[model samples]
Target chain A: MAKRQLLLLSSSQLHGYEFLEFASRDITDFLSKNKVSTVLFVPFAIKDHNAYLKKVEKPLNQWGFKVEGIHNQENPVDAVEKAEAIFIGGGNTFRLLKALYDTKLVTAIRTRVLEEGVPYMGASAGTNVATRSINTTNDMPIVYPPSFEALKLVPFNINPHYIDAEPNSKHKGETREDRIRQYLEEKDSCTVLGLREGALLHVEGYNAVLKGFTGAKLFVRDQEPVEMKIGEDVSYLFKDCA
Target chain B: MAKRQLLLLSSSQLHGYEFLEFASRDITDFLSKNKVSTVLFVPFAIKDHNAYLKKVEKPLNQWGFKVEGIHNQENPVDAVEKAEAIFIGGGNTFRLLKALYDTKLVTAIRTRVLEEGVPYMGASAGTNVATRSINTTNDMPIVYPPSFEALKLVPFNINPHYIDAEPNSKHKGETREDRIRQYLEEKDSCTVLGLREGALLHVEGYNAVLKGFTGAKLFVRDQEPVEMKIGEDVSYLFKDCA
Candidate 1:
C-alpha cells in the first residue's frame, strides 16, 4: 500500500499578492518533490470551470507543470485514477462538495490519494473537503450537498481562512471562535484545525507539519484552543477516532 | 381560513441594546394587534432551552404576554396546535432546523401559521427558518439538518444579520454581497431579502412591510441589489415562485 501525501493550503491568495503567489514556493516544491509533471485540477468550487482552469494554468504553467481541468474529461473518475497529481482550488465549499458528490469524484479522489499515493493539494474549500467533513466552513451554504461528509482524507476538520474576532467591532454575529465552539458543542469528539491565511499543512504518510508564514490553532472537544507555530509537527492530530 | 401573520426579525440583539430590545416596539405591537395572550417559544436553536426560554420570558412578560417553551411541552406538535403565537429565538440555524425536523415541528408549525394563522415571530435563525429555505442564513453549518427546505411560511428567503463588505479590509473571504450572489447563481429564480440587524419584516395575510431602525437589501436574479428603506411596503416580494 502506498503512503498518503497531501498539502492543504489555508488560502490560494494572500493580501497584496497574485493568485497562489504567497504559497508559490511551497506549492512548486511539493509537486517537484513528489516528481509530478501534470496536475489534474478540480475547479468545481467556482461557477466557471473554464475560467478557473485558466487562472490556475497560468501559474502552474509558469512553474513548469501542465494543468488539466477534471470538468473537461468525459470520465472524471478515470481522470483521477490516471492523474499524476490532484489539485482542488478554492471557492464555495457547499458548491464544491455538491459537485464532487454529483460527479462521483469523492470516493475516486479519496482512493487515488490514499491508496495510490497521488499528491493531493487543496486550497480553501479544497482543504475543507480533504478533512472528515465540511462542517466547519466559513462559506455560505449556497447549495445543499447530499451530505456534509467529505473525502475524509484526513482525521480532523479544517476551518480555512480562520480569523480572530475584532475586539472593538460592533458586529453582533458570532465570531469565528464562537462558531467553532458551537461546532464542538455538537461534535464533541472531533478535532478542528483553524488554519490561518498564508499557512499550509504538509502531510507525508502518518506525519503532518504546519508550514508557511502564519500559525494554526488546534481545537479539541472541551479544552481551550492551543496555538501552534509554524514548523510544528501536528501529526498527533491524525490519530484514529470514532 | 385565517390569514397567516409573521414578524421576522434580523437579530434579537443590536450593538448596544438588550436582547430583542431593538425590535421591542414592533414585537409588542404585532402580538398586541393579533390579540395574542401567550407565546409558545422554540428554544432549540441554542444549546440550553431553559436559559433561552428565561431570556425571552423576561421581555414578553413585561409586554403582558405569557411565554411557554415548546421544549417543556409533553408533545411539541401539540403545543404548537394550542399556542396563541409561535416565537423562535436566535442561535444556530442548522441546529434549529434539525430540531424542527427531528420533533416533526416543521409541518406542524407551517400548517399552524399558514392555515390556522398562529402568529409567528422569528429572530435571526428563527427568521431564516420561516422562509422558503434556510439556504440564505449567515450562521455556520455546525449541524446538518435532514434538508435545507424550511417551513416555507413566506414566499421568499431571508438572510438575517446581512452586512456589507469592509471597504479597506484585507480579508480574502467572500463578502456578504458576494455570498448572496453565489446563492443567486445556484437558485436564480428565488428572491432573497438581506435583513440588516435592527430591521424586520412585518407580514399580515398578503401584505408585508419592512420595519425597524435599519434598512435592508433586496436581491433578485440577474439584477442589481435594490436598497430598501425602513417602513417600505415590500409586499411585491411575496409573489409566488418556483
Candidate 2:
C-alpha cells in the first residue's frame, strides 16, 4: 500500500488571525512537499458550499494553488479519484459526513488518501471524519446521518478545538475533560486525541507527528491523559492500526 | 386521552446549590398536585445507576415520596408501567437514550406518561429525551444510539442548559444559537426550545407553562427567536400536538 498522508488541524482560523492564517505556512509546506498544484476542496460541512469554497479559495490561490469545490463537480467520487490533493474544511461534522455518504465519496476519498497516497488535509470537522468515528465531536446533531462511522484514515479519534475546564466557572454542565472521559467509559478500546486550538497532527504512513503552535491531550482508556507538546512523534498511536 | 403531565427542567442542580435544590420546590409541587407518592427513577443516563438513585432518593424522599430505581427492577418496562410517577435525572443523553432502547422502555414510558397520565419529571438529559428527539442535547455523543428519535411526549424539542455565546470569547466553535439555527437549516419544520439554567416547562395535557427561576428562547424556522420569561403560559407550543 502507498504511504498514507494526512494533515489534521484542530481549527482553521485562530483568534485575531485571517482564515487559515495560523497554519498557512504548515499547509503550504505540506502541499509543496507533496508536489501538489491543483487542490480539490470538500466544502460539504457548511450549509452553503459555494460560499465556503470562496472563503477557502482566497488563501489557497494566494499560495499559488487552484482550488475546486467537490460540490461543483458532476461526480464527487470522480473528483476525489482524480484530485492531486484533497482539503476538507470545517463546519458541522454531521452535515459533512452525510454529504460524503450522499455523494458516495467516503470509500473513494479513503482509497485515495490511504492507497493512492493523495495528500489529504482537514480542519475541525474535516479532521473528525478522517478518524474512525465522529462520536467525540463537539458539534450538535443538527442532522442525523446513516451512521457515526467515519473515513477511518487514522486509528484514533480526534476531538478538535478541545478546550480545558474554566477554573472559576460555575456552570453545572460537564467539562470537556468530563465528556472525553465519558466517551472512554462507553468505548474503552478506542483512543481519543484532544487537539487544542492551533494544534495539528501530520501523518505519513504510520509515522505521525504533533505539529503547529499548541499542545494536545492524549486520552487512553483507564489511564491518565498524557500531555503532548508540539514537535513530538506520536506515531506509536498507530501501532495497532492495520 | 388522559392529561399528559410533564415537568422538564433545564438542569437538576444550579451552580453553588445542592443537587436538585434549585428546582426542588417545582418538582415537589408537580408531583404533589398530581397526587403521586411513588416515583420510579430512570438512572440509566449515568454509568452507575445505583449511585444515581442514591443521590436522587435523598431529595425526593425528603419531599415525602418513595423513590425506586428502574435499574433495580427485574423488568424496566414493568417498572415504568406500574409507577405512580417517573423521574429521569441528568447525565449523558446518548447513553440514556441507548439504555432506554436496550431496556425496551421507550414505548413503555411514552404510554405511561402520555396515555395513562403518569407524572413525568426530567432534568437535563432527561428533559432532552422527553421531547420529540434528543438532537438538541448539549451532551457529547459518546455512544451511538439506535436513533436520535426520542419519546415525543412533547411536540417541540427541548435544549436543556441552553447558554448564549460569550461576547468576548475567542473560541471559533459554533455558539448555542448557531447550533439551533443549523438544526433548523437542516430540518425546517421542527421547533427548538432553549431553556436557560434554572428554567423548566410544565405540561398538562395540551397546556404548557414556562416555570422556575430563569427564562427560555423559542426558535422557529426563518423567524427571530422570541424571549420567554418565567410564569408565562407557553401552551401555544402544544397546539399542533395531537
Candidate 3:
C-alpha cells in the first residue's frame, strides 16, 4: 500500500483571515502534489450541512477540484470509496463522530485513507477525527457517540485551536494546559499534539511535519510539553504514538 | 416528597479568594439552617481524593459541621443514606461521573438528594453532575462514564465557570456562549444556565433562585439568552428544562 497522506489543521479561519484563507496555499499545494481531482466533504460537525457544504465547495472549486458533500450523495460510503480526496470540516466533535458512526463511515473512510492512500484533510473537529480518539478535543459532549474511540489514523490525539494560559486573566476556569494535563492523568500511554490557531500537521505516512507560521506544543503523559518549531520534523510522533 | 434542597456553585474558589471562601457565608448558613450535623463529602472529581477532602473539611469543620469523605467509607451507599448533607468538590467532570458510576453511587446519592431531602452542595464538576447531564461542563473528556446522564436534581444543566467572549481577543476558538448554543441545537428542550465564577444557584425543590454577587446568562433553544440577576427567581427554568 502507498503512504497515507493527511493535512490536519487547527482551524479553518485564522484570527483576521477569510474562510480557509490562511492555509489556502498549503491546502491547494497538498492536493495538487497528490494529483487529487475530486474531493468529498464531510459536514456532519455543524448543524446546517448544506450551508457548510456551500462554504467549503466554493473554495475547493476555485482551486480546480470538484467538491461534493457526502451528505448530499445517495451512497455516502460509496462516495468515500470513490473520492480522490476527503475533507472534514470543523464544529462539535461529538456530533461529528456520532454522524460518522451513524453512517457507518468510520470503516469506509479508514479503508480509503489508510489502505487505499486517498489524501485526507481535516480542520478543527475534522482534525480531531484523524487522531486516535476524541478524548483530547475541546468541543463539548453535546451528543454521545457509541464510544469515545475515533479513527486511529494518527497514533496520538490532536487538540485543535489550543491556547495557552493568560498571564493576568481573572477567570478561574481550567486553562487549555490544565485540561490537557487532566487528560494525561487519565490516559498514560497517549500523547497530545496541541495545535494552535493557524498551525497544522502535514503527514505523509510515518513522516509528519509541524508546518505553519507558528510552532506547536507536544504533550506526553508524564513529561513537560516540548515545542515543535515551524519546520520541525515530527515523524517521531508516529513512532511514540503507538 | 419535601422540596429537594441543593446548592450548585460555579467554582470552589473565586479569583484571589480562599478555598470556598466566597461561598462561605451561604454554605455555612445553609448547613446551619438545615441543622446538618455531619456532611458527607464526595471528592471523586480529582485523582487525589484525600487532598480534596482535606481542602473542604477544614472550612466546614470550622463552621461546626463534621465532614467525612465518602471514599474513606466502608460502605459508600450506606454513608449517603445516613448522611445529613452531601458535598461534591470540583475538578474534572468526566472523572467525577466515572467514579460515581464505578462505585455505583449515582442512584444512592440521587435517592438521598431527591427523595430523602438531604441538602446537597456541589462546586465545578460537582455542580455539573447535579444537573440533567454532564454535557454542559467545560472540563475535558478525560474519562468516559457509562453515560453522560447525571443527577437530575436540577431541571436544567449547569455550565460552571462560564466565560463570555473577550471583545478584543484574537483567539479563533469557540467561546463558552458558542458551545452552549451548539448544545441547544442538539438538545432543544434543554436550557443551560451559564454560571460565572463566584455565582451559584440555590435550588429548593421545584423553585430555584439565582444567588451570588454576579448575574448568570440563561440559554434557551431558538431564543436569545436572558440575563438572570443575582436575586432573580429561576423557577421558570424548571418548566423549560423538562
Candidate 4:
C-alpha cells in the first residue's frame, strides 16, 4: 500500500512567506497540482472564514472532488474511510474543536488518517488538530469546553508564525518571543515548531522534510528554541518517536 | 535604620502601555497623588525619568523629600541599600534585565529587598522581575539569563493585557489561553494570572488581594484559561511545582 500523505498548511495563502510555502499559485490548483485527486473532510474554519464552506468547496470542486460538510450523524468514518484524502482547513481552533466534539468526528478523522492511512491535510486549526495537543496555537481561548488535545498526529507542539523577539515591540504587553520563552521555561521535552507563516513540516511515512528555509526556529517549552532550514537533517517525528 | 523603599513601574512611555495609567485616569492620579513627608531614597531611576518617576514626583516631591535615581556605577549597592523606597520602572524587560545583569545589581536589589525588608513597589518590569521567571513576558526576550527566582511576591505567571483571542487567524497556533492551559497541564499546583492593565495583585504578607476592577484570568497551559475577577479567592505557588 502507498504511504498516506499528510499536508499541513498553517494558512491557505501559499506564497510570499519565503520558506513557508512549497508552491505559490492557487490553493486548489496547488492541491491538484500535487496530483492529490480528492479530499473528504469538513472545513474547520473558526475566525475569518470559520464557517467558510465555500472556500473548501471551491478547492475541492476545482480538483474534481465532491466535498460535503460532514454532520455528526453522517457517519464520518464511512464518508472518509474510502476517500482519497481528508483536507481540513483552518479557522478558530475553539470553534473547530466544538464542531469535532459535537459531531464526534475527531475520532473518525483520527481513525481515517491513522488506521486506514488516508491522507490527512489541514491548515491552521486543521494543522493544530494533527498534533498531539493544540496548546501551541497562537489563537484565543475565547471559547472553551473540549480542551486542547489535538489529533496527536505529531507528538509535539507547533508555534506557527515562529517569530523571534524584536528589541522593541509595537504592542505594549508581552511579545510573541517572550511568551514562547516563558512557555519553554516549563515544557522541556515537547518540540515547538516556530514556523514562520509559510514554513511547514512535510511528513510522509517515517520521513519529514523542511520544505522552506533554514532560518526558521523551533522551540520546545523549557528548552532553548533553535533555527532550522530546508534540507537540514530532520525526519518525521511521529513515526520514529512513537 | 530607614529601610529602602522600592518603587517598581510596569513599563516606560515608549511602549503604548502604562499599567495603572492606561487602565484608568483614577489609577494614575491615585498612584501619583501619594504624599511622603519623610526623606526617601530611590536607587533605580537615576539615568531616566520613566513614567513612574514622572507621575509620582508631584506627590513625592511635595513632601519635601528628594527624588534621586541610583545610577552611580561607583557603588549602586550603597544607594539601593539605603533607599527608602526602591522604585522599578517599566520598560523592555530585556533592557531592565540587561542593566541589572550588567551592573550586577540583581544581587544587591535582591538583598536589599529580602534581607533588609525593603518596602518595594514594582510596576511592569518590576512586577515581571518579581516572578520566579519572567519567561511569561510577551515583550522582547532581550535578556534570557534565566532569573526564575523572583521576589516571590506572587505564586503564578502573569500574562498582561489579557487579550482573549484575536478575531483573525485561522491556524492551530497556540493562543495565550492555550499556553496557560498547557502550563497548567504540566503543573497544576501553580496558578496563572491573566491580569488586565488596571488590575494589581497586592501582596501584603501572606494575604494576596486583587485591587481594581479589571481583575485577572487563570490558565494552566494545555487546559482552559479562566477569568478570576475581584472579590475572588487567590493563592501562591512554589518554584519546584511551576
TM-score of each: 0.98, 0.98, 0.98, 0.52
Write candidate 2's Cα lDDT for B1-242 as tens digits.
Answer: 24799999999978877889888888889999989889999998999888999999998899899999998999888888789999998999999999999999999999988899999999999999999888889888888888899998998888899888889988888889998888888843388899998999988888889998889999887899999999999888876433
- What would the per-residue lDDT of candidate 4 be over residues B35-140, giving only the tens digit for each residue? 4223233323222444445555554455344566555325776767666556565544544655666677777867766667555666566666665555455443
Question: How many pairs of residues collide in model 4?
Answer: 65
TM-score of chain A of each: 0.97, 0.97, 0.97, 0.79
Q: Is candidate 1 or candidate 4 better by DockQ?
A: 1
Per-residue CA lDDT of model 3 for B140-228, tens digit only, reads: 88887899999888768889998889999898888899999999998533999999899999988888888887779989889999888
For candidate 1, list the clashing residue pairs, or say none.
none
The 10 consecutive residues of candidate 2 chain A with the worst lDDT sum are A183-192
Worst 10 residues of 1 chain B by lDDT: B233-242
- Provide the fnat value for model 2, as a fraction from 0 to 1: 0.66
Worst ten-residue run, lDDT, model 2 chain B? B233-242
Q: What is the C-alpha lDDT of each candidate?
A: 0.92, 0.90, 0.89, 0.55
Fnat (0 to 1) per candidate: 0.65, 0.66, 0.79, 0.07
Q: Which stretches of candidate 3 lie over 4 Å from their true place?
A: none
Q: What is the lDDT of residue B239 in candidate 4?
A: 34
DockQ of 1: 0.80
Q: Pick the candidate with the highest DockQ.
A: 3
Model 1, range B74-191, lDDT digits (tens) per residue? 9999999999999998999999999999999999999999998889999999999999899898888988899999999887889999898899988888899999898989953389
Residue-wise C-alpha lDDT for candidate 2, range A1-242, written one tens digit per residue: 34798999999978878999899888999999999999999998998989999999999999888999888889888889899999999999988998889988889999999999999999999999999899899998877788888999997889999998989877788988999999889843388899999999999988999999888999888899999999999988886433
The window of 10 residues in a row where model 4 chain B has the poorest summed lDDT is B1-10
